[model samples]
Target: MKVFSICHVSIVMLSIIIISTNLMIPFYTVVAAETNCSNGDIVIAQSRVGTLPSGIPSFSVEITNACARGCSISNLHLKCGMFASAVLVNPKIFKRQDVDDCLVNGGSPLAAGSTISFKYANSFQYPLSLASATCG
Candidate 1:
């Protein structure tokens, strides 16, 4: 038998490894794609309404992190409306916190299984029959 030098043996082994890795890359990518990546996403829903600290009508939206990783919140367009016997109420988000939050922290993130909420406020008195508000 002939003995190959260490340098030559090293180069041969490295070439084989590189070729194997290249061949396996596509298979690895396909396997990764088959996994359920979308299962780890976020969910938003209309939660409830309550009173603001300054005695105003306020409502909220619940955001839950259903993702396996952190989820970012940004450009959250929130609109308000009421349906009380043909009455129109243009509610506004008391966004001192929200507006400043976007500027300060772009795309606020929530960890997996965590929940955060956005609140909207208006000065609608009780028995006025304001029906529903929407946030997205």
Candidate 2:
């Protein structure tokens, strides 16, 4: 009888600990689910080659939020699809005009019809064959 009582109490304590842990995790999951944004929200996206003040070759990519509601994007970067080694040489991130405002307000959570630009500095020349220059 003593052994059975101890075992039952141990199981009950373990169950309580598990339930308490599970309850604390809902805060983050709920916040994330509320801000869910799909790929279809981006309607206007474009990229162009630009030059910095010193005439260093640079690339600029922009994305606009076209959905009726707001969404969040943590970070966007350039990705080389094929022959990544030979594609870009010494690519470095640079600041653009309006991007600083976005970071000041919040990293993510872009309002509807708003646009964001990301810049990168590189010596890549124009007319280079690229598999796909995309921002994600």
Per-prediction tally of clashes: 0, 0
Model 2 CA deviation exceeding 4 Å by range: 1-36, 43-46, 52-55, 69-107, 125-136
> Per-residue alpha-carbon lDDT of model 2 for 19-94, expressed as tens digits?
6556432221121223334455554333557677776666654556564544434332222322122224332221
lDDT of each: 0.34, 0.37
Worst 10 residues of 2 by lDDT: 1-10
Report the Cα lDDT for candidate 2. Answer: 0.37
The candidate scoring highest on TM-score is: 2
Worst 10 residues of 1 by lDDT: 1-10
Candidate 2 residue pairs in clash (backbone atoms < 3 Å): none
Give stretches of model 1 more than 4 Å off. Answer: 1-40, 52-56, 68-105, 123-136
